[model samples]
Target: MSATVAAILVLAVGTYAFRLVGPVLHGRVELPARLQELLAAGAVVLLVALLATGALTEGGAFAGWARPVGVLVGGVLAWRRAPFLVVVLGAAATTAGLRAVGVA
Candidate 1:
């Protein structure tokens, strides 16, 4: 099949599988502790992977300063346990201010 057709089939199958999982798992069986830990770690791993990849890209292979600046500010904000909205706004403002002044 063509790539587009294959993609549609995969998406449809995956969506149906997940939608089925909810009803199939409706208090039928409790998640094992090990499985729970693995699931939690999987989420964290995916988040870190995305950040290390190009979630905040400027359309290049790490060719922008906004990402690093935002990461630093966000890291600091998290380290200090600041509010989520404030941390996000601070990161955006830092990236915007830096780019506006031609730092990137």
Candidate 2:
């Protein structure tokens, strides 16, 4: 398998193994509420971090001005209940305009 696939499999299997271990080791599954809360919070944190990592980065740097402007254009168009094509056009238009004007 490719390194990326192997890494993904390892991570997935390791996570499942650890999660399953809790129940297997302790037949009486009675964890405190706080621990559960922390785990849930950690999951949310991980999700947010993953999203931010993609939405807030580009080409080895932060997402920078043009990308956010494109996203905002798309969002505004979407907020106005524009169609999918219009929203995509809005983002494309915004990105093209910004780049033409050297906003990046």
Candidate 3:
């Protein structure tokens, strides 16, 4: 196999093994309540960090005000429990409108 294919196979197997480890060890390892709560909070923080990074940067630089404002509109709709379609469309429209007016 080509080097790239071999590397992909190795990564796929490694990912599967890591996934299997969780199910295999489930119920066998008991985590402390505080640790569990911290883990949950960590997951939320990680997601928010990812969202911010994606929204605020492009090519290692600022993505411009348009993208972040679009994200904010979507976030507000989501927080208000808007439907998924409305959230996505609202963000897209906000970004497109701003770009149309040369905000970026």
Measured by lDDT, the strongest candidate is 3
Q: Which scores higher on lDDT, 2 or 3?
A: 3
Candidate 3 C-alpha lDDT tens digits along 1-104: 89999999999999999999999999999999999999999999999999999999999999999999999999999999999999999999999999999999
TM value for model 1: 0.68
Judged by whole-model lDDT over C-alpha atoms, candidate 2 comes out at 0.85
* C-alpha lDDT of all candidate models, in order: 0.85, 0.85, 0.99
Alpha-carbon runs more than 4 Å astray in model 3: 1-13
lDDT, residue 72, model 2: 73
Model 3 worst lDDT run, 10 consecutive residues: 95-104
lDDT for 88 in candidate 1 is: 92
Error of 1 at 88 (Å): 2.1
Total clashing residue pairs per candidate?
0, 0, 0
**TM-scores of all models?**
0.68, 0.50, 0.85
Of candidate 2, the 10-residue stretch with the lowest lDDT total is: 47-56
Please report the candidate that would top TM-score against the real structure.
3
Off-target runs (Cα >4 Å) in candidate 1 are: 1-14
- Candidate 3 — which pairs collide? none
